[model samples]
Target: MSDVQVRGARLEDEAAIREIADQEMAAQEALDPRFGFRPDASGRYSVYLRERIRDLDSVVFVAEVGGAVVGVAIGTIRKQESLFELRRFGYISDLMVKPAARRLGVGRALYDRLLTWFRGLGVRVARMHVAARSDEARAFWKSVGAEPWLTESWVDVPAADGPPDPAGSEAKPAPKRAAGGYAGDLPDDDPSPAGMADASDDDTDTDDDTDTDAGDEATAGEPTSTRGADE
Candidate 1:
């Protein structure tokens, strides 16, 4: 990560950003279709994310090695009356590091940049989503202090072949479990309002309620033509 700079993406960065995204997407598709990029929504997705970046309310951070874009993290501030009610929130929508950049802490650096930016913006909660079955992702998030709290179900369907999942028993929120879905709330930060939010990340380590892969979607604004995977 030496010489790597973390900075806010610019409209002029579209090509480089897209290149990183495309590279990340290729890796994702190869790793899991649920986490891959949408080939069809290429034009629109780029435009949408760039718009978010331009708005300032949203943030997009990246790590570059000697000028080669290696990683990116994207998210925004959102307000809603949902369970995790808050006057404001910093929502992470996407995060990725190029294959060559893995294990270099590029992901962590980008995460911190986005996190510090969010904290400065009054974002009280940090969240991301991962496949229930993706052990590596699970481990990664856990290692970073993100713990799992929900068992996602697609269709909300009737009892099928799977065992009747132990009813509401699991919905119980973690008491000592911090708010990042795992760790406790940030020091001096409001805990109740933050606790109510079940924020989660997509392939980007972002918000909780959006369309992810695995039939079970994460939470966030709909970015059409965008293919993504999260729990």
Candidate 2:
């Protein structure tokens, strides 16, 4: 095992984190065309990380080996609907470890730090989204005691034409649902460039330790890109 040190993220770490995030995003996009980056994603992600580092309800952690950061994890507190049994839950937004650092415990160290912070905030259950097609991701989460809480479905919505089919004059057929799962869930801040409607993620968490898969698997051999639900 490699000697890994985990600590809270500082402002100076934004560039490194963004670089890893970019690589992860590109890799996941390759897995599923639906995953994409926004205009100036680097700058935008840097800004987003900076804000997360300072936010009281959010936490960012970094894992270092030989004095260089090789892994990162991000999480935030979320309020559930009043009707839910748990009033608030912990949402992992991003988790990543460099490819070279896989299996060295770097990702797990970073994750443990985030969990510590979440527990400090009184969060009882931690939740996240994983890429649907990544067998690696699913296996990793299973090793860590996280089961599939739900499956998210996706579909394409075609543009409407001619005033809703003239109020029932030959009603149009329903749009076809898109096949396959998401590349992964996107970070809240990493939306497509302006003028593009946000593609809402069916899953809720993001992680990328394996690079393409998100969720707990990112902590082992993978790194979730975007929110790939690994966060």
Candidate 3:
């Protein structure tokens, strides 16, 4: 890792970042069809990376070895709900390192740099999501002191014929879990109300209802593409 260089992502790094993201999305899509990326996802994500690179509230870090980009980590500051004690936190949007770079410090290097940026902004906590089925991802995050919580559930849109009967597609609950579903509070009659999903039975993590200890490290989100297997 002594040779690994972690720095802020540059506009020129967009192609490299998108390449990694493409691979990540493709892998996740194979794990579950719901994780599919749009055919034009690469172009759209490039636009997003450009915006994030220039946005004061966001940070994108890239890791390089011998002048080659090997990894990337992206994050943004988010306002917590008015009901929460903490007002703002850093949300890790994506973490990816090429498969060949696994087990190196690249992922952690990118993560730590992004984390420093968050702390500089006075962000008190950091959060992200890992697919429930990605044992390697979960293990990598846990190795870095992230605790797992909340199962994010997804259901196909019920036919719009009636009041939206979701019972047919409801996901089974993970054992012993109490909280976590979609993040927002939708009305009871809301057609798109989210339901709890068990990680044991789920592949993607989308949204969750969570309570964090100040400055804790963690994981939760939609399926992450290529997390470094630093464990």
Candidate 4:
């Protein structure tokens, strides 16, 4: 077994951190059509990842192979409803490792460290999302006791019928649903509104959470792209 280390990510690790997120997004996009995450041309994803690194309520774990980050597990210590009040749930935003690094415990080690971090924060539950059809990822989560807490679905509202004006076509989104899974569970009531999770994660838990598959097998390794559930 190789000597791998796991610890909190530093801001200086932004470039390497973003690279892992980007690569993981690429893998997810290839499998999950609903969660198709696409990176901008900037090759810089810290606009989305920076806050996690600095969050007192969040944890970002990095696994280094030969001193370079090869896997990541970024999550928040959230107070998800129905679970508990002041719940310290580790909502794993992303987890990825290079194909060459697969099955080397890089991921398992990272998970162990972050899990310890969450437990230290007094977290009652932990959450993560997986593609609906990724065998490798499903097995990985299963092996680590990460259950499928929710089932996710999505829709495609065709753009308005009109001339496809270059740099002019806009995709009008649907209104909010009060009982939806992801989109339904947002804490808009909080003074700190997160602007209703980015359009990318149409699967937000804005209201209530229903994770029927919480501990079920996660086959999120399909060959397609997917956006976030909501916020």
lDDT leader: 3
lDDT, candidate 2, 1-231, per-residue tens? 568898888998888877777766665566567655555776776777788789988778877889988767777666654555766666666666665666666655665676677767777666666555544444445444455554556776556652454456665686653332123233344432211110011112222221221243222122344322122
Task: Point to the candidate with the largest TM-score.
Answer: 3
TM-score of each: 0.62, 0.72, 0.74, 0.66
Q: Against the hidden true structure, what lDDT does model 1 obtain?
A: 0.47
Q: Residue 124 CA error for candidate 4 (Å)?
A: 2.1
Q: For model 2, how many clashes?
A: 27
Model 4 misplacement above 4 A: 39-44, 81-88, 156-231
Candidate models: Cα lDDT each: 0.47, 0.54, 0.57, 0.46
Answer with 2 or 3, whichever has the higher TM-score.
Answer: 3
lDDT tens per residue, model 1, 1-231: 256678877777778766655554444345445443445544644776567678867777766778877666676665644455444555545566554555666655665576678767666565444443333344334444554444444454455565665673544554664334322222233211111111112222322322222211122211110112222
Tens-place lDDT per residue, model 4, 56-92, is 7766767787887766666565553454443334555
By summed lDDT, the worst window of 10 consecutive residues in model 1 runs over 191-200
Give the deviation of candidate 4 from the true structure as CA RMSD.
9.4
Model 1 ranges with Cα > 4 A deviation: 30-38, 82-85, 156-231
Question: Which stretches in model 3 have alpha-carbon errors above 4 Å?
Answer: 157-223, 226-228
Model 2: residue 230 alpha-carbon error in angstroms: 14
Candidates sorted by lDDT, descending order? 3, 2, 1, 4
